[model samples]
Target: MKKHNYSAGPSILPQEVLEKAAAAILDFNNSGLSLIEISHRSKDFVAVMEEARSLALELLGLQGKGYQALFLHGGASLEFLMVPYNLMTKAGKAAYLDTGTWASGAIKEAKTFGETVVVASSKAENYTHIPKNYTVPTDADYFHCTSNNTIFGTQMTEFPDLGIPMVCDMSSDIFSRELDFSKFGLIYAGAQKNMGPAGVTLVVLKEDILGKTGRTIPNMLNLQQHIEKESMYNTPPVFATYTSLLTLQWLKNLGGIAEIEKRNNAKAELLYTEIDRNGLFKGTAVVEDRSKMNVTFLLEDESLTEKFDQSWKAADISGLNGHRSVGGYRASIYNAMPIESVQVLVDVMKELERTA
Candidate 1:
């Protein structure tokens, strides 16, 4: 049976991208060696790295805008530590917006470096909404926020204009919509979500933001060192970076973020519309704050859970189960998820309601 994948991370990728990646794995660039066996410093892989970085900036409208894109090894979790290590001064503080589990995890990492202030949080409300009207400390080294919450399905529509550098973790929603990419001092995302796969993380930052924290950052955690080395301070994740390059190429060929955003909006609308209109279901996140990537919702009749589960499973729907913390269904309609797949889920929902 054909499965409609809705897993949150290491999620669905474009079918063409997957096919190309599989081909490369068997014979990268027609070379007899597998992509994994190639040296990171080789001419072919170097070209791949350079083009991937360049394409990332080009797609984001950040080219020639003093931004450097680095495809790093550790996931966004490492970036949580690297952010403060390379940006926060020995005495300087950092401010963060607590929007979800990952945002809270970032705050926890920052606290160990220096004073970390949570400017605003919706945690008390179970993170169903994004906190607003909160103040970020102007004196902080940098301000941090997560663009989207995958587990809870909340996204920040507007960002505050802090005089200080603004940092963001766009792990769940990067490249899915149009945004003012220049406003951010730093942006990082795990490739597993919308980019490529789990082994690589994309970090884009302004060149001027580094080498000012007054803390001696370790070479591995140093952004400037990685930049100077051109994202090759050590052996990079070969397969992950190449697959990400293929994915970026796919996006560029399909127009860009502007084009993908339209498809994403249509998918979100299709699913959320069903969740709201169907009497059997209800949305988990606030209407205005709902995520275009991950759509979290619940069945109105909890007693019908088994029937609904069986229904989706029978239809060959996978990864519809929500996180343990949320305890409902989450349909992660990422950039690559087709509207046709969404309609399948909506049909399942409608069928459940009719039979119940």
Candidate 2:
């Protein structure tokens, strides 16, 4: 049986990408050295870094001006700190929307550097829905939010368009769906989720937001420093970057982010339909705020959970377990996942229904 991967991060990748990545590990582009062993300072590696950054931005349709994109080292977690460090000033406080684990984590980090106001919190209802109608204070530094709550299976489909600058940690759904690049002053995500393997982080920051902080930021945390170096201030993550480059090439060839978003919508719809239409199952997230990347559901009869696991695993389906916080089952339908894989899981659910 062909096993389908449904794990979240370090998760599914294009089969073709996997094959190419494995082959390159031994001999990169016939350069006669392993991709893992090469110097990140070499011309070949520098070209890899440059192309990856350029193509990633191009894929996002950030072609014109006023915006700069970088693939940095830390995950989005670091971005929570760096964003406030660079964008939030001494007197001004940044506003954040508390949605789930990652959003709260970002809030915690931002507090150490500057005053952070949590404008709204979804934890009131267990993070099943995005908060409705929040206030964005003008005097605040910038508004922050997590685009999608991966663990809770919720998404902010309608972004909070505060008149002030906006920032988001789009880690789980960065390139998975459609977004307006102009609305955000800064954006960051760990590469492990939708983009590539777990090394480089994608950051999109408006050029105007950099120098305003006026406080001394550590060089590594300074977005301007990394941007000025063309993301080569130190040794970059070569293999992960190469994977990201190829992924961008793949996205471009398949059509850009818009086309990919359409597919993502279809995939999420298909899975959610199965969950709703199937007997003995209930969705975890609120209907109004369901996530396209991560779908969490519960079985009507908790006793059958083990059986469901065995049945799916016996069919070679994998990674359906939910996060420890919200337990039941979660199907992480990330970008690389195909419709057919979700169909397999749905079919498995149907078979179980018939058997019961």
Candidate 3:
């Protein structure tokens, strides 16, 4: 049985994208060979690459900003180090907000390269809510922020206003909603969560922000290098990047981000409302800061988690278990997750409530 997938990264991709990806794997665009067999430098493949890059930038309306979009190999984990290396200068300090697991990881990695300042942190409250009222550095090299917290189920309601250039890790929520990119110097996200697959990562950087770090960054890790080469510095993750391109095409056909944002909000609201009203369940995130892509909840009886997983599986629903670090249940409702799927899970939750 095909179950509703709620895995965080490498999560769910649209069915249409999957179907088209499979067909391309066999023979892409009727080129008489499989996409996997095509040369990355081939004309046919190059056209696909250009289209993908164009669509990605077009989606963000990044035409006027002189920002270059790069679809590269390695997940966002690589970006944690690369962001600091390329942006954090020796004379400057980088500011980071400790939101949750991934944000903390970014902060930890940044310290090795330069002086990092923690502007705000929510660890004392167990990261249940987004921190409000924080100090933003005026002279910092760049301010790093995570738009969404996957493990703790919280999201930054309003990003901090820092005078310095803003750098963000949007790994889990990029392209999920509308946001102005003019305020950010750079934004990086692994494509697996919101775009398509596991092997590619997206980085959008403003032209003015590069070449300012004086430190010597490796060729592969430099944003300017990737930008100049158009993300084909090496062989690149051809298949995964193309799948992301196809996904972007699907998004455009579905009325772009506006239409998808409506659906995403509705799906999140439905699950969150049920968790809020359900007698045996309680939400792990604060109402104001809950993530629209991931709904996290806990049973009154923690011991029943395993049983809840089994029951949901028997009902043909899966991937609802929460991350181990912050455990109970996590329903990652990414863009591809349908409202009907959320309804199914809500019904299952009601059933469990009545039986209990």
Q: Kindly give the number of clashing pairs for every candidate.
A: 0, 0, 0
Give the lowest summed-lDDT range of ten residues in model 1: 1-10
Candidate 1: lDDT of 71?
94
Question: Please, what are the lDDT tens digits per residue for candidate 1 over residues 208-326?
Answer: 99989887888999999999999999999989999999989999999999999999999998898988899999998999999999999988889999999999998888999899887
Candidate 3, 1-356: lDDT as tens digits: 56888888789999999999999999899988999999999998888888888888888888766888889887888999998898888888899999898899999999998789998899999999888888887988999999999888888768765678899999999888988877888899999899989999999888888888889889998888887887899998989989999999999999988889899989988998899898889998889999998888889987767767777888787788789887788889999988888898999889888877
Q: 1-356, model 2: which lDDT tens digit per residue?
A: 44798887878888788788899899987999999998988888888887887776777667675777788888788887888999888877999999999999999998987778998998878999999889888899899999988789998888866677899899899887777777888888888888889988989878887788779888888888998998877778788888887777777777878888889988999989989999879999989899999999999998888889899998888888999888988899988899999989998899889886
Give the distance in Å from residue 166's predicted Cα in candidate 3 to where it truly belongs. Answer: 0.6
Candidate 1 is scored at a TM of: 0.99
Ranking by lDDT: 1, 3, 2
Q: Scored by Cα lDDT, where does model 3 land?
A: 0.88
Which candidate comes out best when scored by lDDT? 1
TM-score of each: 0.99, 0.97, 0.98
- Against the true structure, candidate 3 reaches a TM-score of 0.98
Alpha-carbon lDDT, every model: 0.93, 0.86, 0.88
